[model samples]
Target: MGESRERLWTRDFVLLTVCNLLLFLTVQMQTPTFPAYVKEAYQANDFVVSLVISLFSLAAVIARVFTGEALKTKSSKILAIVALGFVAIFSAGYYWAGSIVFFLLLRILVGIGFGMGSTTFPTIVSNVIPAKRIGEGMGYFGLSTSLAMALGPLIGLGLLNWFGFGSMLIVLVLLVAIIFPLMHFIRAYNQLPVSSGNAQTVTGIRRFYDKKLLLPAGLNFCLSITYGGILSFLALYGKEAHIENVGWFFLANALAMVLIRPFSGKLYDRKGHIAVLPPGAIFVGISLLLLSLTTTESLLLVSAAFYGLGYGMIQPSIQAWMVKVVTPEQRGMANGLFFNSIDLGIAVGSVLLGVIATHSSYSVMYRWSAACLLLFLIVYFLSQLAAAKAKKAAVASENVGV
Candidate 1:
């Protein structure tokens, strides 16, 4: 039992979690502040602000694919450090971005850094944690991101209100700087063992296109799309709706995730994806529907809780499932494909939802989001059926041999 506990609480896990938390916090801190900044600095419209937000994902998708390939030969520690350093530098530039074009250039640079670091961290975690505890460790690691998403905007907006954008940028810079030193602690844990003889050559990108990977990858894509709408438009929607204390929505959401994730991770480890995933998807669907109907702050807060619980539960479940479906040699590419799916969802959701909001109401965006969830639910159930059938067939083949 001591050994079991120690497996979960390694130095590498702690260091990686801290690094992920700090890096993600920098990104989250800017989410709300950047739109406001673009609006104020360049006198931009909603479409332009949306573009500013979506551009990050656009760059991240391309970078994630390349970064995944690079990890086959490169050091995750060096890549992660360089990525964080770039974030710190470019985030600091938010202070001096006088025009929209310059601000966008800086945002793109930040995206590149973000894509590289984010992809590398998961790959590193896969290396450090014992194979048996991958799901549990990944769940804990993912909480850093969930917590940042929950808190960063609230803190960022408070700082922005008190000290303005320049001060907010400084805080982001400081947060990212913390990762530079902390990264060294993770270096030893980051190295994967080299194969004997020549390094095995990977073939074309088609290696990433495994059929077993498609189910979890599709789930990730849809899940991210659900969140992208909420993250990109929720604040603006709240302001337009005249809801008071909008930050509390994010706070409530974060608190729910913090409360749920550790237990969910343990549950995933003890049970399996089938036990945890269906409920998570259902909760997310309900939350999106609730979000569509909410007008009061109370209803919105409740929606946030539902959404957070669903998001916190489902994301790790999908990741655990993805990792389990691939060989160790292919884990990096699988993770890359998984992250790319997420980026694709976020990119498409932000742009398409932004267009929808431009033409209709923000509430309409949530309603459409509800429809998307219905589609996700159908696909999820079908996939589960297909997996069950395949498992049964394999078992039957073995029984016949017996």
Candidate 2:
């Protein structure tokens, strides 16, 4: 067990990670780029543009709510492939969308596919990795996502600048399509044998969702809400701040994530969530506060570094913790709940902040985001304290032969 845990790298693991990276690259590229495209193409206002973007998250939340139950009937790879097909089809439809209304509908289709595919990839990867080293392995796997976040929008904007919106859409479509062949290269693990105890549990909606994941997922939702603000407005804010390019903020954030994820994951596996999450949350809050005050390029990049470190450390640790608490059969549900909450957060944040920014300013908007993170920190510690007490009571009852 010890030896297997340390042997983190394997062929399937590499392939799955690469597959996830490619998928995320396509998703990330669309995030910032699409909103700009919608605004320019349709002369839409910030509220309208934000609604179009947040619509994807809303669709994703709806899709993920049922995706866990769907996984129970199908293999993760099978579900992922079908979902990828959804992304591929809608990506091309972007070229034909003549109006914002039509484009919003297409975005919903893409979101459904994306939510299902993203959830399954993590579920499959978690099962392939050594159980003891799950945190460490997920850390490495998450780099694919972090790197995509760094470069996807940059790539999207570059394509738009060099070619046009149609060409950019083609590139995104191609990226989603590339995963089809790559999926064949991956050798997925066999299904784990379900114990009778698990098999006998009542089948219902509750069975399809993991309640154990709520605390970490809720905390993740808080952080991602702030992330939604960055996604929705950083480019506009950069222009407002007189910075030449604001995309570099994501580049800086991704770099910091790349630097810190491995170490943070190892720390979680060794010392548990207490060793990582609280500090990570604080870092994210500070980053948001700094971003609120960004008057210089250097300060902007510094804020990115803080955001990267905080998100990179906290996100994977939450995922690792989600997987840790559930049985193998329940991983699908846990992952679905985890990602659904994240998308919901981003969706709510985008719409709510759009209203706030309209009424106030982007700077004020980010300060509110920072406040949300600080609130998350307090909530997280309280949850942790409750969990510790519950755990202690469980041990005591076990000693009493419950």
Pairs that collide in candidate 1 are none
Q: Which pairs clash inside model 2?
A: none
Query: Total clashes, candidate 1?
Result: 0
Task: State TM-scores per candidate.
Answer: 0.89, 0.91
Q: What's the lDDT of the predicted structure labeled candidate 2? A: 0.85
The Cα local distance difference test for each model comes to 0.80, 0.85
lDDT of 1 by residue, 1-402 (tens): 857644767788888888889888888888778888788879999889977878887777778788877777687777887788789898888788878898899999999998888888887777776767777877888889888887787788889999988888888899888887787666554467444365456587665556788888988898888777876788788878788676677788888888788778778878887777778878888888888788898998899899888878888878877877766555666677887888788777877888988999988888888777778789988987987999999999999999
Q: Which portions of model 1 miss their true places by more than 4 Å?
A: 1-6, 187-190, 193-201, 207-209, 236-242, 351-365, 395-402
Tell me the lDDT of model 1 at 187. Answer: 53
Candidate 2 C-alpha lDDT tens digits along 30-118 = 88688888888999997888777678877887787677767666777778878999999988998989888999999999999988888
Runs off by more than 4 Å, candidate 2: 1-6, 40-48, 98-100, 189-199, 354-360, 393-402
Error of 1 at 128 (Å): 1.6
